[model samples]
Target: MADLIFYTNPQSRGQTVRWMLEEVGAPYDTEILGYGTSMKEEPYLSVNPMGKVPAIRHKGKVVTEVAAICCYLADAFPEARLAPPTSDRADYYRWIFFTSGPIEAAFSNKAAGWEPTPERQRMFGYGNYDLAINTLEKALTGREYIAADHFTAADLFVGANVNFMLAFNLLEPREVFVDYARRMTDRDAYRRAQEIDGRLIAEMQAQQAPQPA
Candidate 1:
């Protein structure tokens, strides 16, 4: 078995980690789990009690959460150059966590039709969907990369969100966001990861389709 094991569902946020893994050029094994089934039962739960997809077990250590997995892989495979040097990781840590926290929270809340009132904005880290998205747009305005001059794992996480949000109409099609997402996803690694997941999704959908009696 490969030292790196990736547990994921193709339709889930696991796609982001899949891109990161391809960028790292590591030989990892993928375990496709279904929602509310294997993902919520047995040994998978032990790996991540949250019963989430996109968990990675590297060597012996297990890392869950999408952003965390991306960061871990970058550090674990320095040769991939997916992370800036430890001393030069100010923006790296900044943007990655920002996306993981406030941005994600804002998007999720917005999708669920629950935007906080202006008076209660202070109580929420993201304030509101517009506030969070505008911040991200400004950060990427003139930058080709989120964390450094070159691509990093931060881009993978942030870009995946941007791409997904834009695709689903969850985010407005702002010029800056569109340009940044294009640059981040215009990579061989990203394409390969998407193809893998796309095929998996198709297979899963076919299996779930009602049979023609």
Candidate 2:
């Protein structure tokens, strides 16, 4: 048996995990689930009550959520050097959760056209899209990686979000975002994951298309 069992959908946040998996170079089996059917039914549900993609079962333990999965995998595969050293983990953890929380909320709110008032913005983790964007840009400015001048699982999540946001127009096109996207997407592992997921998405779309008359 492979050390890990990855349950994901190519069209979902699973793309992030796929890149991390490749970066870690761990042995894992991927089970692609379809929307509304396999993903919402049992077996998969037992793995994640939320019925979310990008869940992993490793050593009979289940880990769900993209950031959690990336952090877990990095720790699981110590030799991969995907996690920062113990003493240097502040930036690693900081950026990972920052991407997952504030950045995610900011972009999502913008995409949904849900702008919050200044008073209410205080309650929101991101404050607003501009604040979130500026914070992230400042972090990435003049840096190749988010933490410790090297690539870690934190970079994987940040890179994935930037690439996804820019591609879908979910975020504005800032020089920081564009440069970071170019640098992150240029990785061999990221490219490999994209090709695999792109092919899978294409296959799914082809199957869903109507048959020729």
Instruction: Give TM-scores for every candidate, taking all chains together and pairing residue i with residue i.
Output: 0.97, 0.96
Instruction: Compose the digit string of candidate 2's lDDT tens values, residues 1-213.
Output: 787999999999999999999999877899999889999999889998887797999999999999999999999899989998899899999999999999999999899999789989889999989999899999999888888767789888999999999999997898988988888778899889889999999999999999999
Which runs of model 1 end up more than 4 angstroms from their true locations? none
After TM-score superposition, the amount by which residue 95's alpha carbon in candidate 2 deviates from its true location, in angstroms, is: 0.8
lDDT, candidate 1, at 32: 97
Best lDDT among the predictions, by candidate number: 1
Q: In angstroms, what RMSD does candidate 2 have relative to the true structure?
A: 1.1
Candidate 2 residue runs with Cα over 4 Å from true position: none
